[model samples]
Structure formats: structure tokens, C-alpha cells
Target: MTDKLPGLHMRIPPQPITERSTPRPVQRPENAGAAFQEILKSKLETSTLKFSGHAQARLRLRNIQLDAEQLDKLEEAVDKAAAKGSRDTLVVMDGNAFVVSVRNRTVITVVDRASAKENVFTQIDSAVLTD
Candidate 1:
């Protein structure tokens, strides 16, 4: 060590700067549009539509009967509801009422013509009427 004056300080070395590498591309599901179209088409073509447990019970209790034509109308209503980004929808067909889940293509509840007279639908984002 060399002799130095009082209150002297030592210098430190600097760190090297490194370039960052490029990030990898993000992964996502393929054929989203095709999948949506396929599901919609399948639902439209089916002879019958699916109902949730609560809806089934309500149908039995309310004596609501849906013929093939009525089911087709319901499917069409659901297709339109899905198109408009409706998650929960109220579909009215021939005086009957249905609460549908658009994303899952399911009818969550049902109200017959008689019950529908005084029914007030809630928690639905959209309503479609099939005359």
C-alpha cells in the first residue's frame, strides 16, 4: 500500500451492461371462431334442447310443453343472444318463458304461459322474443 493523505477514498469497478433476449410468443387456443360456429350449428340442428335440473322441474310443475317447433325457436333465440354477447338471457317463445345461459347453451329456468303472466325475470342481461 502507498502512503496516502488522511480522509482518502478508493475507487470501485463498474458492472458491464448486457442486452436482454427477446421474449417468447404467447400461446392461445386455436380455431375459436370455428369452434363457436360448430357449437352454434349443432345446437340449432338438434331436435331437442337441454334444460338444467331446476328448469326441468319447473317445466314439470308448470305443465309447460314444448314441441319440436318451439324448441327450434328457443335454439334460434339462444343463437341470437349469444351473438350479442349475452351471458344470461330471457327467451320468450309462444307465451312460454325460459331463462337461458348463453355461454353453456342451457335453459336454467322455465315459466309456462300461465305462470309467465305474473313472472318478473331477474339477473338476465338480454331478452329475446320468438313470436
Candidate 2:
């Protein structure tokens, strides 16, 4: 039986253990959380508004021009609509009406004051007036 297991009786020499070099200290920014928060805030503010192709074309065809302030208001309106769980919303700001898809944060169409006078807005769950 012992002769049949000759190869299984072989011994392996152990290697000496060496001390490992200490790892370098990881340097982290002191205000990393604050920096991340600031970046998130800026991104949220800048990416708030998005216009669809139809909305852009409607705006151009209607000769509607929205300045920075008006755009900010519209964005705020969309935010409010989203907060209230609105999927489709009608946002009226500065006499301009915008049909917004709250879930996508996109403007589907624009209606100027003149066109909005007697036009009916459909498929909207909520309306936000930012005037």
C-alpha cells in the first residue's frame, strides 16, 4: 500500500514570509461632500428644461421668445408640477402657454398669448400658472 502511494508522500518546501511595504495614505478632499452637493445643484439647475423638436418649431413659428427669467419660471413651474405628481402639465408664464411632459422634463409645445386665447389644452393632468 505504501509503495503504491509513493508520489503522494512527497513534501513541498515552505517559502519564507516577507513583510509587505505599507500602503500609501489615500488623500481625499476635505469638503468632498460639499463639492458633490454643489455639483449636483448646478447640474439640476442647468438640466431643468428641455424642449422637444415640435416645441422648438412651434416657438419659432409663433415668434415666441423666452428670456432667461421666463425660462427659469417655466422650469420652476415644471418642478412644481412634478412635485404634485403630474405627468402632463400646462404651464402658463408671461402670457405664453407650454405643454410640458413632467416625467421627461420636456416641453411638447408652445402657445403664444394670441393663440392661447380660445384654444383648449387637452391631455393635461395639471396646470401651473407662473405669471
Candidate 3:
């Protein structure tokens, strides 16, 4: 007795493997390292802190303005927080408080001194006080 399932029999022919007649030589740019360095430098130079929509709104609502120097200091604070492996950080510069996400290099929110005094900050792993 032969046991077989009731189904159509489908068969496919096997393909033959073909070898290339001539092996292709690997090509590399002569100034690859220098090109990569240029790219890295440009990226580092252009990199800056980003503000979330909520943070922007808060800044506008509070009439808060950040000058070039203050923004630079805030970026430095975020870098320090990142070095310390902080995910969320509270950064206080001048009289303003900023909640930053170190990994994202973004300002999550902003609070003035008056509002900061009444609010309790949460979900932050570190705090940076910068001048």
C-alpha cells in the first residue's frame, strides 16, 4: 500500500551556478580618509541644539529670549549632561530653566524663574547649572 496526499505535483528544475570569467578589482578613493574627516567636521560644526514645539510655545508665551551666548552655554550644558550619561536633564542658565533631552540634543521645555519656583521638575536624571 502506497500512502500519498491528494495534491498536484509541482517540480522545478535546479539552476546551474556560473562563475565570472574575470574577477572585479575593488576600487577605493585615494582621499577617502580626508573626505570622511571633512564630512565629520562639517557635521560637528553644523550641529546645534533643537527646541521642541512645546518648548517653543512656552518660550513665546513667557516672552523668553535666548541670545547667542546663552544658547552656546545651553549647548555646552547638554553636552556635559550627555557625557554623564543623563537621558533627561534640567539645565538652569541665567534666570531661565530648561528641560533638555540629552540623547536627542533637544530642549524639551523652558520655564522662567518665577514659574520654576512653583513647579516641581520630574523625570529628570540630572541637573546642570551653567552661567
**Cα TM-score per model:** 0.68, 0.65, 0.66
Cα lDDT, all candidates: 0.85, 0.89, 0.89
- Ordered by lDDT, highest first, the candidates read 3, 2, 1
Task: Provide the global lDDT of candidate 3 against the true structure.
Answer: 0.89
Clashes per candidate, residues 3 or more apart or on different chains:
0, 0, 0
RMSD of 3: 4.5
lDDT of 1 by residue, 72-91 (tens): 78988988887789999999
* Local error of candidate 3 at residue 18 (angstroms): 28
Model 3: residues with Cα > 4 Å off, grouped in runs: 1-46
Backbone clash pairs in model 3 (N, Cα, C under 3 Å; residues 3+ apart or in different chains), count: 0
Model 1 earns a TM-score of: 0.68
Among all windows of 10 consecutive residues in model 1, the one with the lowest summed lDDT is: 40-49
Rank candidates, TM-score, best first: 1, 3, 2
Candidate 3, 1-131: lDDT as tens digits? 86676795776999999996897897989999899978965664467999999999999999999999899899888877876889999999999999998877889999998888879999999999986
